[model samples]
Target: MSNVLRIALVDPNDSTREMLKAMLLGMDTVWLEADCSRYEFFSDIIEQTAPDVGVVTLDSDEDRAIALVERLSKEAKDTVILAASESTDGHLILRTIRSGAREFLTLPVTKDDLAAALGRVSQQKFGTADGGGRSCEVIAIAGATGGVGTTSASVNLGCILASDSRNSVALLDLDLALGDADVFLDAIPDYTLADVVQNISRLDIQLLKQSLTKHSSGLYLLPRPVELHDTASITDESLRKVIGLLKASFSHLIIDLSKTYSPVDMAAIEAASRVILMTQLDLPCLRNVVRLMMSFEEIEGLQSKVEIVVNRAGLESGQISLKKAKETLGREVYALLPNDYRTMVEVRNNGVPLITQAPKAAITQAMRDLAAKLQGKSGGKVEAEPDKSAESKWKKFWPGAAKS
Candidate 1:
């Protein structure tokens, strides 16, 4: 087990606090063993736990939340400050931001929202040492458009790289408002990223470990909070601080960026060491890729770092050709993956990597090849050409018999 990402929560309501604690406890990597509610009690939790992120719900008096944010950010220079509100008031939200709150989520938090926020917090921590000293490598994965298998790729790749005997990897889901890494992994976490934002003043490795979901294969996941409203609870600065912490603890950090760009996503992209841009043959997907490529080029240090990948590259179903795609984008494709339905479906159902279950399958082999490519490993004997047509085998094995 690697170092944990410490977090704190400060919701006035006892039930809310307890619920948040329980949710955080579900993450095998996060240790929510401490609770600091009272002002006096908080000092002790800070001294004992030394959390890396702090989450605090908005109080009746907005000043308290603002004060908490300022104090936490100063006390824990690297700590991430997350502020939560029951109502969405523009004024209060702005005030929270002005006060140094890094993240903002509306009331009634969900699992996905929490995961994404924490994932950002964790990834930001990566690439930098404790107290923000050392520089490290950070990887960001973004799909050309929705459903381009970016999330699946990011998760599986993180698992593969982290599984390496010599390296430690952390997979962060940065689709802050609507990420689903937990569902994919079949994990129902007790704590969402909400807990971390509520207590930014005192964050430490032990507290951080208590917030992450660890797999049997040693993959650490920071899922997104399920509820959209919970996104308002976090701020951009808070997100960056958390990512810094992640860089500090892990050797490799993989971030899955949602199709849509937001302040949070842009921040992750800016901090990334490499950006894996995923696209398919469809025009819509290709167009988006072009736009993102153009946009990334404008950002400092991104033009030369973007890597393009053409997924489902075979000429069977998709309309666009590799030559046309290259001509249109003016960039060579990094890697190609054939459309293998059976293995992909199994992966969707089991939430495990295809290589782990069906290593010999074409899709599995492609993923292994992709992993090697990402690791910059070349000269290995590539697997034989895959039977892309074998996907039809599953059609005949459908659970329900179709009427002729």
Candidate 2:
């Protein structure tokens, strides 16, 4: 176990302060050193408790929050200040970040997010001497278009990764309005990502784990909100914070993204250690892949991290060949998943992974192979036959593209 982080809570509202107090008490890794509802005696309380972390709620009064953060930075230089608010507005976040707040958290704070923030704070204050050299790998999965198996690949890959006893995995459904990662796992979670974000001020790892729906295979899921209207509440800052928290808590963070390329989606893709661009072997999908790749190339250093995953690899005779896909995308195919319609349908209906339903199936083996490759256990790479003609045709998509 890592060293326990000591924290003090300061909030104006009685209900909000108590909620934060209760959340702190529930977490084993964090100790509530002091909790108060007034800013007047916050310095005295900090001096008394000597907490490692200070959590100041800014939802009621941003001025007070800013003052408290600035005061703590000046007086108790050793203590790290974390500002909490309900607002995801860029201006407010910028203000808090500028005012010496080590991290800005949206209210209804989850345990994972808070813990992750503390871990970063701890590392900054005490270096790796206390964090035990902890780190997390974030993998984001995106589809070229719909029905390309992005969610399925994310869920199963998470499951496979979690199957290893040493690895702790979390599958985050970032699709927001239309996310169905829970449906694939046959889980009806009590809490969704919206619930966590709305109450981010009070979130802790213990509370977060309670909100997550844990599968039998040890994969924890943070599903998308049920109400479509709730999706509007999810802001890019909050999404980034949530992803940060997930990365802090889980060893392997697998994100299932939607088709749309919103700011939040871009943030996820940008933060990912590897972005699995899932696509089918079809003309439309291939064309879309080329376009998306071009977009990614515009963002510095993202193109090299993208792994092209060709799902339903051998589905039909007339579809785009592997050679053509490599030629069109100008990247090596990372992995190929077989077309197992019956197994996929059965697993989807039953809400289980192919590994559990049909472990002997070729699709299952393909997923395992993918997992192994991702884990760097296998050196095998899919080599495509040279197709200079296809390459030239695809290059026409980017008119002014300079050769790297």
Candidate 3:
């Protein structure tokens, strides 16, 4: 029950078994059911456990592995056979296929690739997003530009979502070097994101529950690595694996991403069910929005999920008008948050959420409305009406999202 995948594996070479074990352990969904070095014992183990998936490393002994795969395919018809080898030879892959292996992995298996391959098995079996029974919503919050209140939106929105007693929410600060999500909640953590990835082999739902810092609002937090040096170990693959695991466990996964257009950010964005692009009414922020939209256009299916929200609206009379901003961007603005600098400053300093600290403030109400909208509820005051075409129509996109 702790993990979705109950995996039985066989590796003829004992030298590579430990490496394979570490990679599989790091995956959030994988549970090592039984690992054996002898091919003769693998089928017996698979029959006894009837694991969800069976993995066979072929490089150590291709003929033996293929024979095992063929035997297991018949003997354990319920379990799917997954083959991996350091060799990328087409003939070898064909042999695995002919022998009844359902999937093949080019070896030197990365944690990400390993996780993804196993995930496919789970998906093929369950017909859900992952092996985990639940399909949680992943919300990635990005700034139109730095200092435009993206992080603030992420923090408050997460708190609002977690306020519902039925919802299990996890807030991830993915800014790496300068993330302050933990500070925003006023919780000091004994563990950080780096700790999870570094010790991935031991990661499970129970262990994850123990590692995350829980707030009074019932929101769980996994802040960015405390030391800047720890950020280096957080690869794009590791991040995706962590995010996938969180998605399985929580009802809502809120990610606060950095302004850097790094692979790490893109990985999170790709995993998200919705991307909240936070902007202010300013020339600089608008310009960045244009750039980001154009960039989003290049990626498949990325532009459609983006929901543009104007943060700190009405901060200055001189700022851009919502109408003009929509005309400039080619998409309707989704929501607008009022300017409440003093309230926000107080909330952040006290390490409390806006809803809890300044519940009656206008901005707090706006935040609640925004949360309601995201939660599939009505009563959101700020919207450009229901426009289904807004997401896909790129013609005349603000300054045109086309980079050419």
Using lDDT as the yardstick, the better of models 2 and 3 is 3
What 10-residue stretch in candidate 1 is worst by lDDT?
A: 395-404
Q: Give one digit per residue, the lDDT tens place, for model 3 in 203-293.
A: 7555777899999998899999999999999999999878866865687999999999699999999999899999988878887887798
Off by over 4 Å in 2: 1-134, 380-393, 398-404
Per-residue CA lDDT of candidate 1, range 37-56, in tens?
A: 55334544555656777787
Candidate 2, residue 352: Cα displacement in angstroms equals: 1.3
lDDT of 1 at 388: 36
In the range 285-337, model 2's lDDT, one tens digit per residue, is 88788788778868999987888898988886768778766766666788889
lDDT comparing candidate 3 with the true structure: 0.84
Q: TM-scores for all candidates? A: 0.61, 0.68, 0.68
Each prediction's whole-model lDDT (CA):
0.70, 0.82, 0.84
Whole-model lDDT, model 2: 0.82
Instruction: Give the true-structure RMSD of model 2.
Output: 11.3
Candidate 1 regions exceeding 4 Å error are 1-135, 379-404
Q: Count the backbone clashes (under 3 Å) in each candidate.
A: 75, 16, 2
